[model samples]
Target: MKTKVQAGGVSQSPVIDIQDLSLVFKTADGPVNALHEISLTVQRGDFVSFIGPSGCGKTTLLRVIADLEQPTGGRIQVNGMSPHEARLARAYGYVFQAAALYPWRTIERNVALPLEIAGIGRDEQRRRVDQFLELVELQDFKKKFPWQLSGGMQQRASIARALCVRPELLLMDEPFGALDEIVRDHLNEQLLKLWLKTNKTIVFVTHSIPEAVFLSKRIVVMSPRPGRVIDIIDTNFPTQRTLDIRETPEFIEIAHRVREGLRSGHD
Candidate 1:
């Protein structure tokens, strides 16, 4: 779909647009506020990270974008359409905290499952599965089951599955949070490369400062329960940056700002 530029050629319509969005959960105790007056816009092909403490509604925000959860107040649009509409159109893909791959399915089968569900022909499914497995560097493991692959590799397969659909937007919720630091670092690098190659508009939820700083063009910080955006820090880092970029002074400075934003949110 083509992006629509507004009157006077000011700015293109955002890939994801949310304004004054709020969500509340009904509980035994009464009502719990999950998000409050959250407003944000994500442009096409932008890699944006949402970082916050537990219960800060970062994932809730992502869920809103994915239409997995309904908002109680305000408005949101994905790809210039309602989240529900966008969901119906399969405009986005989601990668959850866990790999969530089925043990019964081989890596290739797992990646091909979505295509099969979408009624794509067998030949197209094979083509997409092979292409995405190679994209994630897991072509060699296509025949293996989820139980046979390493945790990191399993997550890579999950990512490949998400990409096989070729959604314009990707919503990732701490996909690497469960892995060891070393593995997480490596996956982060691979994910960065994947994002660069695919140019997907990614909204990633993470608690790791360095990961957010390293991967995002913009880092959005949120408050505790009744979450509100406390800051939206722009990194503007080059797309081709390496893991070593984390050691740079500019990166350090941005990390410090993110830390401060988190601390301020708590206060």
Candidate 2:
């Protein structure tokens, strides 16, 4: 099946494309298949979510697209370039489940680490660091160490770090899974604003049905072990999504559909 790209309620060229993707791991016992013929496309500036049960290869597939893991077969292109090239060019930013911040570095310096590695000038790095911290609403905490903040605040700082370079694509893996409900909701809303402001393509992985439904322009539902694409649902909602939208009938309808898809996969 061909993957489709939906952006602004219409189809468009994919910013990230995967074709006949497959992955296998060789262990002491034998080879184990993790993913099978997984294919999908994410259009530029679109928020796409990957949802599935645990051990469904959701994270594995993400690693492949991020060039952190190699696929046993198939092809992947990010902005028309191979994943490796994209990684080398720093075209993508990744947010893992944990904040993974350095205990010693202040929040501002943490955000500036990427720029330092890229050899960016100190003045320009400071400018971008401040801009992103404000973007994530962590500007006031820039001088604090990671251990000084709460879990949610640390995650925000990590996000600011990721966005400091203004990457073309953002890849996130259950970024809010560890936070409380209230913090999670607040962060979700803030992320949507950042997405709109930056106009950057985003591919997010999550197991929360409501979270996926609320944030995604499209949701890619995957099946169990040896994961493969099972369904791709377009949200068709307006760009200015809000918490109120999640309570609307249209939003509920789409969420119901996603639930049905997940049930079908489990059965």
Best-matching candidate per lDDT: 1
Tell me how far candidate 2 lies from the true structure as C-alpha RMSD in angstroms.
Answer: 4.3
* Global Cα RMSD, each model: 2.6, 4.3
- Give a tens-digit lDDT track for model 1, residues 18-87: 9999999999999989999999999977899999999999999999999999999999989888999988
- In order, the Cα lDDT scores of the candidates are 0.91, 0.88
Candidate 2 worst ten-residue window by lDDT: 1-10
Give TM per candidate: 0.95, 0.93
lDDT of 1 at 255: 98
- Writing each residue's lDDT as its tens digit, candidate 2 over 1-267 gives 113334234336578999999999898989878889988888787899999888778888889989999999998998788999989899899999999999999999999999999999999999999999998888899999999999999999988888887887899999999999999999999999888888888999999998999999999998776687889999887888888888899989988988898889887
Show where candidate 2 strays beyond 4 Å. 1-13
Candidate 1 accuracy as lDDT: 0.91
